[model samples]
Target: MTVSSETRGLAVVTGASTGIGAATARELAGRGYHVLAGVRRDRDADAIRGPGLEPVILDITHPDHIEALAARVHEDSQGRPVRVLVNNAAVQANLPIEVFAIEEWRRMFEVNLFGQIAVTQALLPALIRSKGRVVNISSVGGRVAMATYGPYAATKFALEAVSDSLRRELAPFGVEVVVVQPGAVRTEMLGRAIAAAGDLPAMTSEQGQRYSGLVRAINNQAVSSTNAGLPAEAAAKVIARAVTARRPRTRYSVGREAALVHVVRFLPDRMLDRILAAALRPHSAVTT
Candidate 1:
């Protein structure tokens, strides 16, 4: 027998094509919520569509998509209240701060920060009406901006700030805003970031010389960390908890690395710098 969303309510998860987003969609659906999983491609839509899970084509940066998503939520046949909105869509690239062109910086922010805000804005009415939660997927980078992670971290850092402000603003209205910070997770995002980094214009010789080893080290470290990191299911569980907890924390760290990052962020700046440098040194050895 199929369960009805009238009893459990609804969940909307963006970037449901892969990784943490996909897992969260399935997790919510399994837990009996009717989930609208947002993906960008027809194939991804087909892949994620099933009982208790409906896939919607959404590109968060597009106003029409955002508008349509809001309409879908408002016009649900079952009239199930939206229980949670998971703003999980994002893009990543590993490049030195100087190597990232202004356009690249804007593009990352478009997807990572602004896109999230747009979705949240569009759904806020329904969320407020249902007293629903907003779950923003940030990162450890939000707390500590690592070398060669400038653009991505900048967006996440901004998101952390936004989540703080939103949480405070929504508290009185019964709606909650929660931020989930995940460290390295086994996801295709690592491979995509590596490929995207390779696709950028060739670095100037001077710029390359200054950053080549650091970039390589960051990439190497990312690969190693992701290989050892928790699977997407772990993150999904944390997100689900944030959605369901009667007294959810304002922020939840998905992995031990993320938990450690929270503590490490309190260290003196120079001390933190030295620790970060030391962590990367083994991977930074330049090869002829």
Candidate 2:
């Protein structure tokens, strides 16, 4: 953790109420950086109690909250510079493409894509002043698609591209953009995905019948996958490395599953497609 005397302001982590965000906040604080922990509600803010951490209520999808966060970061610094910004807030939609609601897609993008852009833009000034780092939390889905996760993967793919472009764009300013992709982390996101898949519209409804099989397959997969996921603490270790390392890597893929997914990305497309198809195929045979 090296910092010049004039530019040791703080690190701001969005989605800081729980899971990876909360873990990252604790990790950064342990590394000796003051942390601006952003949460969606007062209860979330209250939940994150730790040394070197100050909670801020910020809904990334809201312009006013974004502005308020920027103002607060600037005000707290008092001419000092923010050293790190972690854009970690995101949602995963686990519905079939055939049945997925467009509004859900919109919601994911609002927070995962546009909201990230908004917050990064807001924090750039302070980051530039400190020659800071931007660590974006993407997913292995960005590299490889999975069934029933098209909507979520789309956002992660967009985020990965944005991180790449920003890395190039921000280099001259002495700012760094790093993307961290974690695979199947044990988090509440998995629970939500599982629940959503089980509670679908009636089979007679438009798009519902088409996705019944897909939904059931996804629910089963999610249940088993939950046990296979890495701990949030393990992924947080990589975030800490990205934040504190002297020469942080441009990208980090944490956990065994994430690493394997990256390897899958390099495989022949048809072969990978076959593997994915089999993996997602339903266990129960169609009886009709």
Candidate 3:
């Protein structure tokens, strides 16, 4: 369609404080949709508030915050129909499965998986009324879980599955569910994950010795890949297309790495393993 504010309805984007989510909110607004950009902090709210963008305090994990967001959508004074819900709030940690505490794993799922579901459930009525779409921001990790990316990848994998089921279930209602898998992008999350991975206090001495080099390798690969990755605005454009396209694809890959993962996923497990290991080997310089 037409990219006109008079015709476009409201779009809700979670995790809009920075990176892909922030860029997406801006993009949708620029395309003439009134965007309710979700942010956790007042400063971020202030930062993203302008033009067609309205910042909403939404911590998707908190029921109250989600309820408030749903209420806001239902009670729009302008009577704008809900057009899209972009589930972009997520957390990343690069520790190995054995390194993370049970609580940490649960927290990751809480934010990445359950939080998205809760928000979707709360807003389903509005979406159904408008026959809108759901855009989930997954990652290449969703299809290919690398060393030290277990917890975060697990959540994305589950989200991919959920999107599949939701898509089929919502088809009869005219609601579309689309998954966007993005590879390395220039985002603050990469630096945060690298910093978090360097925390070896969670590992035993022997465990640290065994995995520290792997962690460092992963960090190095992350940095190099992200340095060569697309800008957040590029991914935002894809998401905006997913939002506005008349016949959107079920899944959209944002970067070259993501497209490569799509092709490689069909390879034999052993072959994929060798490829992934070889890719990481170049960065595996042991450091004390």
- The local lDDT score (0 to 100) that residue 207 gets in candidate 3 is 87
Model 2's alpha-carbon lDDT is 0.83
Model 2: how far is 60 from its true place, Å?
0.2
Q: What is candidate 3's local distance difference test score?
A: 0.92
lDDT of each: 0.91, 0.83, 0.92
Q: Quote the positional error of residue 43 for candidate 3 in Å.
A: 0.5
In candidate 3, what are the lDDT values of residues 1-288, reduced to their tens digit? 547765798999999999999999999999999999999999999999999999999999999999899999888998999999999999888988888888888999999999999999999989998999999999999999888899999999999999999999999999999999999789999987766655535679898898878888888888889999999999999999999899999999988887766687579989888988999988787342
Candidate 3 ranges with C-alpha deviation above 4 Å: 198-200, 286-288
TM-score of each: 0.97, 0.90, 0.96
Cα deviation of 46, candidate 3, in Å: 0.8
Ten-residue region with minimum lDDT total, candidate 3 = 193-202
In the order shown, the candidates' Cα RMSDs to the true structure are: 1.7, 3.1, 1.6
